[model samples]
Target: MLRALYTFLIVAVLSGIAIWLADNPGELVMHWRGYEIRTSFVVGVGAMALAAFLVLLAYRIVVSFIETPASVSAYLEKRRQQKGFLALSRGMVAVAAGDAQDAKRYAAQAHKLLDAPPLTLLLAAQAAQLEGDEAGATKHFEKMLAAPETEFLGLRGLFIQARRAGDRDAALAYARRAFGLRPQTPWAAQAVFEIEAAEEDWDGALKTLDRVVSAKLIPRDDARRRRAVLLTARAMTAAEAARGQTGEARKPALDEASKLALDAVSLEPRFVPAVALAAALCAETGRIRKGMKLIEDAWSAVPHPDLADVWLDMIEDESGYARAERAKALAARNPENVESHILVARGAIGARDWQAAREALAPHAGPSASELPTQRVCELMAEIEEGEYGDRGAARGWLTRALHAPQDPHWTGNGYRSARWSPINPVTGEFDALEWTAPSGVLAQEEVPAVAGKAEESVAPAEKEEAPEAAVDTVRALEEAGNASEVLAFQPPLPDDPGPDDEGEDDKGEDRREGERKW
Candidate 1:
């Protein structure tokens, strides 16, 4: 509003001045090259204004003529950029939708028009992968690797391809290169760790594990546990290498092994493998007192068969009774432990004390004497019956019970029970995955047998009608269980029946006696 008011006032004043000049009747004169020209003041002003307008018009015409080609070029460039961006968008959509042909088509257009190497290569590689063209994918990945920004992605793609083709060496090479390029990359770090572990490169694996832990790729506790396992393995290997050495040659290796073993035990006191290794190393180095103390501590924490085995190995040459006494002492440390009870039972068996063995395992055997027996408990009972009472039937019954008993604990890993501990799983190459746990509840359940001669028992007539359905289910379960074992009926021989080898055995005996008499 102020600007408009100012403009109105200036225009009114300029008009008044022009009017005054016209009233005064003044003249405008010009002379150029002896050519004199005269006009009224208003005419002169009008002429000047017309000349200025003409000059401006000519200037605009010249500028338009000069910029025509550049303007057209700029418009074309803008159109090209639009097309490139559109192609890029289409290529991304095609990749998402799994349209290999469309993706490849749009990727080529984006490559040409967009002039972006990373996006072009990524799209082309994805399209090739969608079409199962590994060579084409690899070609694009190689191109990506040439650029520093996309090198990590390219390395990862190539690494995956190598692993798919079962080329471990190539995979490892790619993983190492990628890790060197970007140590903080999670995939690169994990790949290096897994490959090093699979190859049994303990030192390299430890370094990779440390890197992974520092990167926070895995939890702190998991890293510590794995480190403990790796250290234990290292110590055990070093100890073995030092076995035949003497003097200074063996001193360093044994000392390092013992230190690593102790560190492992301290990290995880219940880790039976490391405990056993530590005890064995202590005993081998004439540290008998130290070894015994280590075993006792481990037993008190978690009674284990491996610990018992290592303890027994410390004095393997002792008599059965002495061995039994030593195991009893160990078992006393953890009386409530199931494994401790099992160890006590084993010791009693070694000492030929059947009652003691039975008493040791009595609590876990369910309410009945042999009900719900564990595998080891059943085996022990079988041995006891056979050795003490000489009852073949009872022994056979106990052996059958063992087949249906809960599985015994061992060095279990990846659904398998190994006889010994190793740094890696034999099947899956998993590190420190094994634990002293039972194999029960993993596979098919064990089948059970019904009591013999149960058909002679009669049901109560009063309750029969009310419990018919339940009784039927019970009978069905028994029948199914019996069928699982599939006991073969022992048919008696008929009067005319004779085995195929009966005559041969009789003829051989008669001829052998006659030949011996003749000789």
Candidate 2:
């Protein structure tokens, strides 16, 4: 409505102007190109209006001519940028697809046109790395670092390269710089952890881990697990350092580890490494009862092989025979596990239980088995038969059976192989072979009676057994035996006479052990 009203007003004004011009018939004059002419007012006005329209049209034509080149240039530049971006996108896709050749080609093209766009440079570096072109990768990464906008990317690239090259010092430098720039970044924290761990800088690693946890870069659960692993490693290092030192020198480190282990166990009940390390440290510091309690608690939660080993180590002097018997009982709890069987067999051999050892090896023998278990069983059986059992015929038969058993790829006519098994000794912090030797002709006798009656009697009848009754009985027995109080009482004792140098070493070891326990 407003637009119509404005249009009406404008039309009325124009008509009034035209009427006045016509009615007045004023005189007007015009000059053009060295000539003079005179005309009535209306005629002059009409000529002027016509000339004004022509001038306006001429101005429009000139403006169009001026803008044409700029418009064309802008259109072409836009297309170039689009193509460059497309190449970059394709390069990233190629990298994701693991197509190294295509990724490199597209990355090169993108870089040529885009010239160190951070994302483009990152892609190019990754592509170069994939193609094993370390120099090229480094150059691209350096380019990224040269620009302030791409500094973080450059740092990350350098970190990756350093790690790939096994240069812990360089990696740590890059990682620390990146962490300083972006403390909350998960990659930065992870890189720092790796670098510090590689350098055996346990103190630095623990600090980085704490930062990672505080920032929530890693989940609390994951952080604790990692911390515990680191702590265990650190504890092992400290233990090795104090191996031949006086007890006073080693006490602090062991005590620290014990505390860390206790914390770790509280955080994650099933953390075997922390439990084992803590127990070992406790025993080392003469807190044997405490260490035993930790081991027993962990064992109840999960029957870990490490726990058994730690328990054996602690009780070796107390009663090797009793320890072996305890291991056998533990093995009975998890009959289907290969490791459990192996441990039980080993324990039985240690306890001089020849018959029991032979029985344990029966199920794991023959041509359908591996060499490691078979060889271990055979060796133990041979020793028993030749020395104590006095059954050479039985030993030969068992050995023959083991020799004919199916070969396991994991065993090279040697001991068992498991990725989960750490070859490094916790006490020594060094790689050591756990060798097993089998004498010739040491196999289980085919005529031996099966211990089926004992097995059946040991396990409660499925139909008649009351689970709650057994559980109650167990609880009552534990309560009566003061096991709970015993466990609670096993805290590490702070030494009253910690020497000057011992104090620092103690804190360092404790901190390291705590880190591992957190892990």
Candidate 3:
């Protein structure tokens, strides 16, 4: 409404002016150089508007002519860039689709068209990798290193190639450079850490792990576990180096080893090896009471053979009876543990207590069809039969049962099973991967046995004149007269066949995929 009012006012004002102009009959006149010009006010205004329009049109035409060449150049450059990017995209897709030839063709076109070193060289390197052209891939990766933006990418590719070629030193160098360039990158950190660990460079690996934990690359629990394993490894290394040394020279190494072991146990109290090591160091330092207490506490929580070894070693010169008593004491601490029963059985064998040994192992005898006895239990039974009864046939029968018994727990990590403990996995080269447990396919095996069930306290008649009756039932199978050979009649079934072997498997290509560059 306001715009209409303004238009109306302007029209009224124009009408008044027109009326005045008409009434006055206004005109403009000019004379110069023997020429005379005359025009009305409205006619002159119309001529001026027409001349302004012509000037604006002429200015636009001149500017357009001047800009034409540059516009054409920009359009052509944009088209070239678009085509280069399209080729690069196609090459990546071809690589993903496993078409080496098409990937190579597109990569060459992209390399020829694109000026970006990282993008174009990356495509070229991937193409060469697909074609198994190591030389070509190496050249492209090397060229990428010349540009700052692609330096890390180049280093990653070189590192992977070195590893693939089985050049450990070269791989280490490349991994170190990559780690130095970007410490927080997971792949770089992992490569550096694993290589350092594999080389037995404990200090370097520990430093790398520290940085990884600080950067929160892994969970806090995992970091703690790794640190504990590293400390334990350092302790073991220090102990190994101090071997054969005597007097003051040995003390320093043992002290440092003890410190590391103690710190490891502090971080992971359930780690049996660390506990055993710490206890041994305590014993060496003449802290017998401390060591004994550590062993007792550890046994109460989790009984292990390592702990039993250290416990028996504390009184190394003790009599067989005394050792058996000590083993019995250890078992008393962790009465429900299967290791406790095994330890008691071992101690009984040492003391030549056939009845005690047989009784200790009888509970774990092959009775439950679903839950198989451990290899340890079967072996212990063999020992009891040979030493106590002097029966070779019975011992042989136990050996057959042992053949089919379930395997005992071992150090398994990253799908790598080892018979001995290591701070890192030899297969995956990962930290803290070696955990003390039974391997896969035995997740449902229970620790407590159904046969031997619970400990039933039996007081020797000598210790007390009046003792309560022990409710434990003795195994009649092995307790029969020497004339009875039927107890040895049964044996476990044989293991499944692994099928035929291929003798040419050794000639196959290495299965290490980590040593390859891929999209």
Candidate 4:
């Protein structure tokens, strides 16, 4: 409305001036270049205005003509940029799709068309990776490192490549650089931590883990667990170093190890390995009561056989009955857990109390139980039968049942299973990954009978055909036993017992095996 009003006012003023010029018409004359000109005042005014308009139009035309080439160049540059970006986008898509050929083609086209080497370099590296061209990818990643815009990206790429190629030193270097550049980046921090851990650089890994915790890259609980694992590992390393020392020389090292282990337990009280380690260190440092308390606390949170073993070791008594009494006390801490019952049974068997062992195990392993007993439970029953009745036949019968019993829980993590605990997973280089859990495929041949029949089916056909008459007689005898259910009531541990393999081992040997637990 304002613009239209302004336009109307200008037109009205011009009309008023024209009217005034017409009304006050007078002769006007001008001479220029020896030429004379004469017109009415209104006509001269109109002629001057027309001449000014022509001059402005001619100037505009000349300016446009002068700028034509530069304008066209800018337009072409913009079009090229758009096309380059399009190729870059397509290349990224092809990379995601795993179309190596298309990715490579688009990457090359984008590099040729785009002036942005930083942007195109990433596409080129990804394309090369898709094509399985490690050298090509490495070259592009190297080029990226020279550009400030792509430095972190280049570091990440190089770190991955180094790991894939099994170059730990190179990977560590790249990961450290990346971590320094961006401590908040989860992948960078994680890479650095994993590499440091894999290299057995526990101190370095612990520092890296602190950075991870500060950045809040992982959940707080997870960070605590990982930190605990690192501390435990450092404790183990210190313990190992102290083993060669004697008397006063060993005291300082053991003290440090004990402090570290205690710190780990403080972070994760329920962590079985940490608890056990802390307890063992306490015992070594002549703080047996403190170690026992740690085990009891951890057992209540999560009943683990390791805690039981460590608790037994802390006992001053060597008699079976005393051990059984202490074991019963530990079981009372986590009475509802199946491991608690197992612990009691194990103790009773050690005390030669077969009836106590049977009663402890019968709830879980008896015929009326909700589920079949685990291999460890069945084995315990065998021990009870052999120790109590001098009945080898009944013992063997229980052992036979054990062969088909469900597998007991062990230290399993990251596809690694062991009868002992470790702070790190050797397979994945992950911290505190091990947990006392049933191994995968815990139940074997579920469709088969839960007895010798299942074992017979598992044997080779020729072995089954050539089965000795004595073995056959044993199976028949077990079948004819007064009550098969009664035979299944008590379970015992096998030779390869999963209950904390560190028990009875020397401290030096246990420390050596800390990072070398068999998968």
- On lDDT, the leading prediction is 4
lDDT of 3 by residue, 382-465 (tens): 677657644444455555565456667767677566545777777776766666676446433243232223222233435322
lDDT of 1 by residue, 1-519 (tens): 999999999999999997898689789999999999998878898899999999999999999999999999999988988999899899999989999899999989988887778877888888888889999998999988888999988998899988888888899999999999988888888788777877878889899898888878888889888888888888878888888788888877777788899999888887878888999888877787788898999898877787887887787567878877888899899887877878887888888987777788787663545447775677677677657655444454555565556656656677445556777776676777677666556343223212222321344545434332333244335434533431221111111101111222356655654453211
Decoy 1 TM-score against native: 0.73
lDDT of 4 at 155: 92
Q: lDDT for model 1, please.
A: 0.75
Clashes of each: 0, 25, 1, 7
Return whichever of 1 and 2 wins on lDDT.
1
**Per-model TM-score on C-alpha atoms:** 0.73, 0.58, 0.76, 0.79
Please state the error at residue 242 of candidate 4 in Å. 3.2
Give the per-residue lDDT digits (tens) of candidate 2, residues 1-519. Answer: 999999999999999998987789878766899888888988877898999999999999999899989989988888888888899999999999999999999988887777548878888898998888999999888887777889998999998898789787888899899999999898888878765665567788789988988888878877776676666666666666666577576677667656766775776666766677778878878888888788777666566657777777775465657877777666766666665666777777777775566567666653445544543455455555544434344344444443443332220122223313232322322222222222233234333223422333456445223432332243234324432332121112112211111222346654554453211
Question: Which candidate has the highest TM-score of all?
Answer: 4
Q: So what's the TM-score on candidate 3?
A: 0.76
Model 3 alpha-carbon miss at residue 26, Å = 5.9
Point out where model 3 deviates above 4 Å: 1-34, 40-43, 246-248, 366-370, 414-416, 439-519
